[model samples]
Target: MMWKTVLITIFAAGVLADDFSQITAVVTSQCTKNNAEDKVPEVEAALRTFGNCLKGLVDLNVLKTEIEEAKPNGALDEVFKKYCDKSAQLKGCISSVLQGVRPCVGNEYANHINDAQNSTNQLIDFVCYKDGDRIALFIAEGGPECFQQKTENLKTCFLNLKQSFPTVESANNLSLVEKCAKVDEMTSCIVKSLEECSTPTPANMAESLIKFMRKDSPCHTALPVSIV
Candidate 1:
């Protein structure tokens, strides 16, 4: 959730180009494929309502300005502290919108929407309330630079890592051991990249990630030690 927020903040701050249009295209493709053509308009309207609700929650112009001004250091934490204070209200708004739209969307679409909402809630709770201190420390210790400069590298590494595993319809199909191994592989890839990029403090970055995986992730049951 913090990562999504960070990417949005960076884009708002003019650090990245408009790749969101491409993302929108992909989402549109999926929507058309998954939902009945007749229900597409209803789905679009539901998404619009959700967007409008978000607009009412926070001033995008103000948020963009703040992010732009905050810049290279502490921006992520500062933005989170300032804006994520309203995370509870945001979550409530999300739930309310989804409830209104669930009846109109297909079951498959509804399930995906609910899953997205749950993931958002989890990330919000993790970064804004549960592990704020750890997140702040991670950001302070070269997390931003590593993310900013090595985003494509990290993305490529993750994609390649995923390729190593057998393709499955759902992650639930993977056993706990298999999931833990994937998590370990992904962490190792990230840690390796941070070190390769000469991030200001790769160890701290790795430690934070290790702690997160061990304490918060599905792999928690299996991951008891630092992967780095």
Candidate 2:
């Protein structure tokens, strides 16, 4: 989930950096500055533990190779399931880290961090828990085209959306309603890409993406019932 957040942040702004290192620096800096210097080592260690846990579960190079070598027509349900089974442990690790840092950083920072993590967790739940088989099948059938060919377009769409605002900071500060408006455009763009790529754009897939945006977001009531 931390990786998801870091990747999204990078893709949204169209910048790349060492994600774990950036996260550790940001968190450790917070602790050191807020009259919590003594807690710095503890917080740093906890963050490293969580990061190591994630790295153990997800090897980017291996995952990429597996996905690339996966036969389009072959069964990949089991392959994805193997990773999904570790979700519980991943969640537990993050939960513990969050709890350990809360007292040092206070509620505001902890809650902000939690919200970001929750967004990634929601995505995992959607892909692996709520509708695992359907999602796995979608990947098996359309993954190559979407990931290999259209990934740039997807990234471009987000970067463009981010550019529409005055500044990156301003974009990040947008109200939930304003953000959901942009999300609507993003959803349409994605659906269009899927159609152009000859990938199946199931109604539920679009619906789920919208619903996922609404979850834990202040835009729950502002977003439409259907957009696809």
Best by lDDT: 2
Q: Which regions of candidate 1 are displaced past 4 Å?
A: 1-28, 59-61, 67-80, 94-116, 130-142, 165-174, 196-217, 222-226
Candidate 1 C-alpha error for residue 118, in Å = 4.0
Per-residue lDDT tens digits of candidate 2, residues 22-124?
6556656766666786786776666666656677787768876675566464656666777788888867766666655654555445556677667657767
Clashes of each: 0, 0
Q: What do the candidate models score in CA lDDT, each in turn?
A: 0.58, 0.62
Q: In model 2, what is the error at residue 93, expressed in angstroms? A: 2.5
Q: On residues 98-151, what C-alpha lDDT tens digit does candidate 1 reach at each position?
A: 554454444644655555566557666766664255456555565677777878
Candidate 2 segments exceeding 4 Å error: 1-40, 58-73, 97-109, 165-175, 201-207, 213-216
RMSD of each: 6.2, 5.3
